[model samples]
Structures are given as C-alpha cells and as structure tokens.
Target: MKTSNGRKLSHAALSLTVLGALLGAAPDSHALGTQGACQDNHIPVALAPGLPADQEVFARLCLPPGQTPATVQLLIHGITYSHLHWDFPDPTGHTQRYSYVSAALDAGFATLAMDRIGSGKSSHPPGATVSIDSNAYVVHQVVQALRAGQVAGPSGAVGFQKVVLVGHSYGSFTSWYEASDYRDVDGVILSGVSHTIQLTSPLRVLVPLYPAALDPAFFGQGYDLTYMTTQPGTRYGAFYAPGQADPAVVALDERTKGTVTDTEFSPFAVILARPLDIRVPVLLVNGAEDRIFCGPTLSGTVCSSAEALIAAEKPRLGAQVPCVEAFVLPGAGHDLNTILDAQQWFAVAQSWMTRRIGAGADQTPGCGP
Candidate 1:
C-alpha cells in the first residue's frame, strides 16, 4: 500500500510540472484573462528607442485566459491620458485603467492600448514633432514593432498582420491618419469625430463650464481662462456628455497649452481627397450632447460634424468604405458612448466588425426609439 501511494504522488508531481510548462509557453495570460473580473490589463515596455524623460510606453493586454488571437484591435486613448482608460487597475506595475476594455473582452475581442509619445509612461522622444502625423507614426511604429519582433506580453500571442484601430477625440486624428496611411488596419472606429475644422481655438481653454457662456453673444463677456482651472470633465461633458459629468473631469480644462498642433490634419480634407484609398469601413459615434465636435452654433442652429464628415467621405468610399453607422442616443450626452449608449455601440461594433465589414449601408442606429 505504501509503495503504491508513493508512485501515485510522483505521477501527480510530474503532471503539475508539465502543466506549468504549458502555461508558460501559452500566449495568453491568466492575470489579464479574468473571465468577467473588472480588471484593466497592463504591460510596461519601451515603444521605441531613446524616449524622453517625460514619456514612457505601456501596452494594455486584454485577452482572456483560455483564448488567444494573432490579431486584435489596438485602442488609442484620448489626449492627455494613457491606455489605462480601458479597465480597473491592479497595483502590480500598472496604472491608468478603463472599463471599456472589459466590455470589448466580453465581446470576445482583445485590446492593446499604447501610451502616446508625450503622454503618461511613454518615453517622449525629443526632437520629434508632436503633430497628428507624428502621432499616427508613433502608433504605426508600435504596430510594426509588435509585428516585426515577437513581443509575448501578457497576451502571450504576438504578431498581428492587422488590427482594428480605435480612437477618440485627438486620438481619432492619429487613428484616421493611420487607417488611411496603413493597409494593415482592418477597420477603424472614430468616436466623436465627423467634420474637419480650423480648431486652433483659443476658446478651448474653458472646460467643466460652457463655451457658450464664454462667447460674448451668449453669456456676454470675456471670462477668465482660470474659470476652467477645475471641473474639466464637467466642462467637456457639458457639451460632450450625454449625462452629467459629476466631480466632473475637473482637470480644469486647457490640457494642450502650447503643444504644436498641426493645423494641416483635416478630417474633411482627408475625406474629400480620399487620401488613404481606404477600403475598411468606419464606425462613428457621437454623443447626443457633444458640442465640441458636433454641436449647435450660437446661431441656434445644429452643426453636424459627423454628418458633414460622412458626407465628405461617402464619395471616397464609394462602395469601398462599405457602411457608415451613426448613433445619436436620446438623453445621452457626449462621452456617453462608452457609458450610456453602451448597448447600441457594442451592437454596432459587432455587426460591422464581425459580420458586415464590407457591406455598404447608411444604417444609423438610435436616431429614434
């Protein structure tokens, strides 16, 4: 009896060792693959060589434990933020978190977000012009690096021939630029974008407050820029939010002070010129209350940013871009795309990205009940 028991124990140990080896070799990570845990994924790696002191790169890994895919969507965060905007954070060498990634994971897709050059933990390499094109190049370089080299981060798997490029706000500028410039991008999601404008606005300085309040015609005079020193989130969401931004993103407006913005990057221009000869469809989501991108002018008339942009881009796609779906949910404010209108947004993504990427249509969801 003792001899038999010893032999059984030995076999168990051997089995455990083999399992460990397999886990190590597997391309997916258990840390990030938390089934339905509200966790944000993270990877700290250098995006490029010789980054500046203020910048560093972080790769967000959003893959479930048992499953793995060679290709996944690369999520680009908004301006002044890091990839951490996707999930809840864990203390283990991770910062910044977002809930959107978890939703995507539930949909059976993985996401990887990189810290842009001058933001967060990314190494902001000096001597590099921080324009929309350069930002696009940064993402392009990250994609190439991921493909060229075998980077087995938490996701375990590496090398995506192409990825779904997703961007919001300023990130959309770079994302559209990339989607147009690169062939590997299978699709793109431009959230809160539609029209190109001469946006070097001195008025963007006020946030967590109403820009209309600043326009002399509406509120009657020049308010101090300092009024936006807090409640930036509120300011942004007021015009952009479908709901109230409480404690409201009070970063106090004015994030980009003197950052050399490239006025040349025009969404309308890109669409009209059909610059990238793009073949992939674009999913545009605008918050019903978002005024920054698509809002009513003081003239009391609604100016449709998404409408104007799609109008310009439709001809270029001409059976190639496939479909353009715009969803304006009721009672939902801008920035609500990730929160309030979650269901519709998810459906739009799944349908187009998974089933109807090549089918052209003017399917605009949530324009009503």
Candidate 2:
C-alpha cells in the first residue's frame, strides 16, 4: 500500500479506495490530527541476517479516532533518525509540542512508525550489509507483520492484541534485540539506550559521523561509504541539552537527518554482553543530560534521577523482565524527542503505556518488595 500521493494501491485497492475516506472522517480534530487511518506499509523484510525476504520496511500505520486499538506502538527511530524520531515535524510553529506521534495519538495508541532498514522509507541494503542482527531481523519481520494482520491500511489489514516495542537511540539497540530474540512483544520501551554505555561514549558518538555520501543533507542521496551522517553544524554538539535545545529544533534536526550503518556500529559490544532476556513490561526512558548515556565526558551511568535510572538499570534486566520502569528526561539531551521538555517525556511514555500495556488486567505492579 502507498498513498502520501505516491499512489500505488492494492490491499484490495486500499480496501476499496481509502476505506470510506479513512473510516468516515469527522474532522474537527487538531493536535497533529487527521483523524484515523494513516497507512503506508512496505514490509517485506530481510536484507541481511539469514537473508532472502527481498527488501522494504517503511511502515507508518496510525489509527485512533474511529478505534481499532487493542494496543500497538512499534516506532523505533534513532541513529540519525527517521520515522522522524517519533513524529516531530514542528516547522517552526515552535516544536509541535514535541510529538511522540502526537503523544501516541492522544494516548489511545496504535502507532507503527518504522524506517530502520538503513533509515527512512526503508530498503537501503549495502551499508556494510546492515546489522544489529539485521535490525533485529527487520524488527522481527515487523513484529510478525503486526501480529499477522499483514500490515496493510486505509482501514484494512489491522491486527494487534498487544505489541509495544517503541525504542530510540540506534532504536534502543533495535529494541534490545527484538525483545530479547523474539519473544514477540507485549511491552518494552527503551528510549535513548542504556545497559550502561559511556566509555568515551563510543568516541563521542563516533566523532560526528561522516559519509552519507558526504552530507550536504545527503547530497545526491545515493548513499555509500557505509551510510552515516552528522557533521554540518553538529546538531548543537551532537544532539542537544546544553540550554535545553530548540534553535528551531536544532535546525530541524539538521534538516531531516537519517542514515547510520557501518553494520550498525559493530554489534554494541556483543549486544552488551548478552543478558537482556526481555520477557516484557519494561520501560527505561533516559536523557537526564545523556551525553550518550549520562555524562558530559565519561562518568559511568547515573542519569541522576528516577532513582538513578532504576539503580543504574535494574541489574541488567532479564529475570523474566516483569517490572522495570525508569524515566529521567529532565533537561533532555541525546535527542530526547527533539527537546523542550518533549511533552515532559511524552507524559512519561504515555503513562507507561497506560499502566503497562493498556486496557484492563495487566496492572504491572511488579518489581516492588
């Protein structure tokens, strides 16, 4: 499916052409609104890790005002961002209240947002043949095509009995290896990453990257030299926080930036020495001045609050990951969703996605004594 006017339809011609104008529109909706149905799939993953699935990943999904929400968030965006780092357009109307997809569709939830296959509008292939387990096996094939409804849109192909994932910074290391090697999500958020990383903060985020075919905002855009980005105006010192950002959202994040590959930075030290079982119900936020995981230089991990980031990340999460919440945000950095308090960290991640995976019976009050 496709329809941001590029026009190639079919998911039965977008369920009989725009499914009754995207489920009978009743328009007075404003905060980043256009009411329901926002389709633009692509899907077909696998361009690496055990290859052969062809390309595409793109995503988008949406859905809210006109229901169809049994819970779905997905998202991802990070290293040089796309899926516009969770919907941040802000064309100088002064930070559209820092949209985490308009605060997760005003908290009703059903988001998607992808583009991690070598960033935006997916499929880029040869940037050292992408990795981080091929972007966690292309987000576990878009989380089994959003739980087998096959990811279509314009009101067709919907499916989700619960899926959370979220992510950020290197898409939070591809959502901690796709929820710890595909247990198939039910909840997990992550956000600017941390299982503790700050030793020279990966050489200060790889010393302001380089080749997105030599960034003039991706000139000629045929990307090679292993993709990458960040250089011109160094996005207010590699990603805001000093003076809590804004400069027109750091020049519209160096004009819609996206790209990062050299095999996704060498597997983050063997996936942080393997041990994030990720059973579900996890949160993690960050950016309490996160100079690549808290520290302006090199000071180990302690984001200063939220009980010092869940006592420096709850003993490296895994014991069936039942309750792991952590937030921080404060004077944001590490691109905390384009700063300016970012809707106070998207209301603490949509109130922990409505008390641990929305709608009834999963209260998630674990991790206490």
Candidate 3:
C-alpha cells in the first residue's frame, strides 16, 4: 500500500513539472493589454472609389471579452502614423500603461484601427490618387462593412450596432469629410485638430518633409516626391509636448513614422472655407499647448483657451451638428496619446463615448430644442 501511494505521488509531481514548463513556453497574453481575455484580428478590406483597381486597406480589430460590443470605434490615424498610433507600445514593458486600445476595451467598446490607403501595410497608390475625398470614401466603405458584418476577423464576421468614427489630425479631416458626406457613423470624435491652420505654418520649418525615396529607410517603396516625411529629430518638436513625452516614446515615433501625400495637404487649405454638414454628435478634443492650431502665430487672433478655439470653429461647422462638445487636455501637445497625461485623454474619450454612443448603461441626453 505504501509503494502504490509513493508511485502515485511521483506521477503527480511529474505532471505538475510538465505543466509549468508548458506555461513558461507560452507567449505572455497580458502583452496585448487584456490578459488574453480579448480578441485581436488582422483584417483586410478592399476600398471602393479608391486609387483605381480597388486598393486594399489593412486594419487591426480588437474586441472585448464576452458578447460583442454594442459600439465599435473605427480609429483613423493622422499624418505620419499608422494603426500603431492607436495601440502604442509601452517602452517600459508595462502593458497597462498608455494604450488607447486597452482603454477602449476596458470601456466595453471594440476598436478597428486601420492604416490609411497610402500608409502602413495598406496598398500605397500614387500620391495624387490619395486625397481627402478618396480617403473619406474609404472610411465610408469601412463603416458600411462594420454595419453589414462584412469585415471578417479571426472571430468570424463582426458587426456592430453602432459605429463611431474617431480620427486624429489629418485623419480628423477625413472623418469630417466622411460624416459630412456619407452621414453613416453614429458619432464622430476628432482629436489633434482644429478648423483653422493660422498657427500651423511653422510646421513647414519644423517638419522638413522630403520625399520618402530620399530617406534610406524607404529605399524600394516606389515613393514619389509627393510622398513626404519629416527629417529625423524633427518629429519630437513637431508632435510631442515639451518635456511631456518620454524619450523612448519619441524615438519609437521617429522609427515608425509614415508618409503624407501631397494631395492630402491641399484639402486642409480649403476645409475652413467649406461648410460641414454633419448631423451626428461631434466631439472635438485637442491639447491645450497644441502649437499647430492654437499657438501665438496667428497675427490678429486670440485662442488662449479651449472655449475660444471651439467658438472660432463653430461657424465653419454650420448650425447642423446636433451636439458639438470640445475638450482640451492640459499641457498636452499634438500627440495627446503619447504624452504624460495620455491615460487622462483616454478616460475622457471613453467617458464621452459612453455618454454619446450608448456603450454603457446611460443613454444619450437628447440635443434639446
């Protein structure tokens, strides 16, 4: 009887040792910021009215645990950014720090972070073929796919009851166009942007944008002069807030920065003149110290605060938008998600999302007459 008991104990010990070994070899699920509780899928979507021949846009779709989320955020990155802009990698190896994806998931919302047609893994058509109008059409198709369950992820065809279009900088411009023309999204969140470019002229000096072909990093990408990027050591000043962003994070920004097409620039010049016809709830958020839009460069203007900036923009948006809310993060810069108060920005966005898009139990208070 003693020998049998000894044998059984030995067998159990061996099984435990093997299990530990297997667990050690497994990839860290927490690296994805959800402790392996969520789903991440790489989605390939074809764009219509694209740069001819149907260009393909790649995106990363992240879904929270349990049942599908009621609202999905389609995140559009700004100039010189990709899907990574939404899910920034923490240089300190802390998965819980400074990730918009983690914040959205915690707030019970799914995220679809897409690379623009001329950036990241998406098909890079000729620079001239990629414009604000073309990108707006691309965004419209993506929204349609989300509503119709046409976007197939690893978890199978995924659809959402409500789709919110979120954008930063140039992406905000495109989102504005999408909501204005298609009026398909349930809500729109425009970050790192303002209606005016009065103080942004210095950007030409700060960002010495040269042809991507001239840069050694993009040797064989077939880039023309129209595809441009900032010179090295320029992004830190142009995007990050003074003494707010981590050096390592700034380095990552330089390494992963993408291209901006010439055609994308022309649209910005005319945006202030064009009237926006959006009928959905619109939220505009920017950094308090955003040098690009709200700086001292404007000769005959004063935008010392968020209220002043929003008031300046009210006329360009027309009187059609249902509810237009604005917030300015203190001490943040153009890249609000990478600065010291990044989590604060995320929390504000999620709170606003819950209030406006039905992500939480609370219903949206109507825009009263």
Candidate 4:
C-alpha cells in the first residue's frame, strides 16, 4: 500500500535468532533478545525537491512476545548515531539494563527504531538534499505507514493505532517539525533538546566535524564533503559527560558513529522561529549536564533540576500546548542512552507514558487530571 505521500513502503527482515547471537543478545522478555519478533526494514520514502524519489529508510521493528502492541514508539536517533541510539548493545554481556527498546517491550509497547534518510543503513542522498524539514517529511510518512499497516513484518503487514515519536538531539528537532506540521502522532518524547540552548556550545560539535570521507571511520565510504562526522577521539568530549559515561560505550559509539549533512545544520533559526501548535502530550528530557543546552546562568536552560528545566521550556512551548512535561537525567550529558544511569530516565519516560497516554491504542493522549 502507498503512504500518504503516494510512495510504497518496502521492508525486509533478518533471522531474529541469528541477529541476537551476532549482537550478543539473549532471548529474554525484558531484553532485546530473540523471544520477540524483530526485523530490519528498508522503507521507501520520498525525499525533498530535487532529490531522488522512493528513497528507502532503514528501521528495526521489534514487537513483544505473545501479542502485538496497540501503541508503538517510533525511535529517531540524534545526528552521528543510528537506531543503536535506542538499543545500545552492551559489549559487556549486560544488555538487559541498557536498551530503551528492551524496556519498552517489557512494558508491552512495540518499538520501531529508524535511521534518518541520510544516515545509517538508509539511503544516503547528497548531503545537500537532507535538512531538518526533509527529515521531518520522511518521519511523517513513516508514521502514516505505521498507522496504515503498510509496514510489513515476519507475520505480515502490521500497524499501530497509536504512535509516539521518541527523539534525541537532532532527531528531536525533526520531531518538532513533524509534530507541529503533521500533527498526526499521538505523543512525543524529546531528549537532549530544548527551545533554549547555549549558543556557543554548538561550536564544540561543528569545529570537530570535517568531511566524513576523511575520517578514518568513514575512509573510502564514498561520502561527499557535505557529509560530516566528528574527528577521531572526539566523541567523549562532544557527546558525553566525563566520568558519567562508560568508556566501553564511548568506544562502541565511535566505531559505529553516523554522519550529519550540511543542509541539516543551516535551518536552526528558522525552525525555532516557527510557532508550534502541537496539541498532544509532549515530554521533554535532558541530561543535567547537557553541554549543548544546560548552563549555570540564564543563557540556556538551568538543568540543575527537573522543575527548573520544565519552567524554562514551558514558556517557549506557548499556552496553546495542552500538556507538556520535563525530566532531567542527573549527571548525564547529551547522550543519555549510554550513560551510567540511563535506565533511570527510561523508567521515568515509561511511567509518564502510562499515565498520560496509557497502553490502549484507543486511549486518547493527553494530560490526566
């Protein structure tokens, strides 16, 4: 079946058992194991103007054992990351505690973690062809496919009556546009992002990003100069907080890092300037020490406490928003998934979802009285 934009959605899956063994994951209901059905899918999406049509978006869809879920969380990674952002495979054989995907599955929610059009296993159009707007368009199509049962799985075509967008960093920016423009999703969970930000902090990321082709990680990978990645040995400083992140996770992150396009970087001011009219339940999460958006003074958000962060963001979201919430992961940085206490925030999100949106697909997403 064709998506709302008139493009067909295509998908493929690998053997779940084989995938589990390869990633050192075991079969467990509370872990990203082989018990549940999981597939790596390539979904066709139309790109922005002047780009090729029918570009495929790569996603990993995992449903819980015994029954299909009525509600699904569509995971979008930050720049320089992949679907792994949501399901970080623990290199130490302790995968049970680290993955947000696993936690959601254990809570009876399906999860679809996807790579944006220009990153990970997805189609890499010219870097100039990718932007926050274009990425948002792709996400909207994916949401429609999920709701329409156009995304095929091992059992057959599967659809969710409710979809919640879960985004981190740049993914949160894309979610902002999608939730505002399409207003199709049931809920949104945004992390590592806020309307207020430390203006000078972005230089810490931009200064280190050279052409991905030149980075030893992407050498001979055929990326254009517009495809950007951090210099080697820079992930720890740029994305994680010292002494709060695991070194092993940082190493794995560097080894599997993704790219960001130049086009994705140029539209920040315009996007923030546009008014948002999202009418669903919106949750904002950030690391207490997020170097990009947290600071000591009022230049950016005061992430010292959750209440403070909520106060900082509430005014920016406008009175039109019905229900908005915030959480701050203490001692963590921008990359919340790989930090020491990552699961703490994951639990917070899960609990919040249950309270606001509930588990039933027919449940309307809003603030509970």
TM-score of each: 0.61, 0.32, 0.84, 0.88
> Which window of ten consecutive residues has the lowest lDDT sum in model 1?
1-10
lDDT of prediction 2: 0.72
Q: lDDT order of candidates, best first? A: 4, 2, 3, 1
Give each model's whole-structure lDDT.
Answer: 0.46, 0.72, 0.71, 0.78
lDDT of 1 by residue, 7-44 (tens): 11132333343244334322122233244322222233
Per-residue lDDT of 361 in model 2: 34
lDDT of 1: 0.46
Candidate 4: give the clashing pairs: none
Question: What is candidate 2's TM-score against the reference?
Answer: 0.32
| Prediction RMSDs, each to the true structure | 13.6, 19.5, 9.6, 5.5
Off by over 4 Å in 3: 1-53, 200-202, 295-303, 360-369
Q: Which regions in candidate 4 have their CA more than 4 angstroms from the true location?
A: 1-35, 49-52, 295-300
lDDT of 4 at 83: 84
Tell me how far candidate 2 lies from the true structure as C-alpha RMSD in angstroms: 19.5
Worst 10 residues of 2 by lDDT: 25-34
Which predicted model would earn the best lDDT?
4
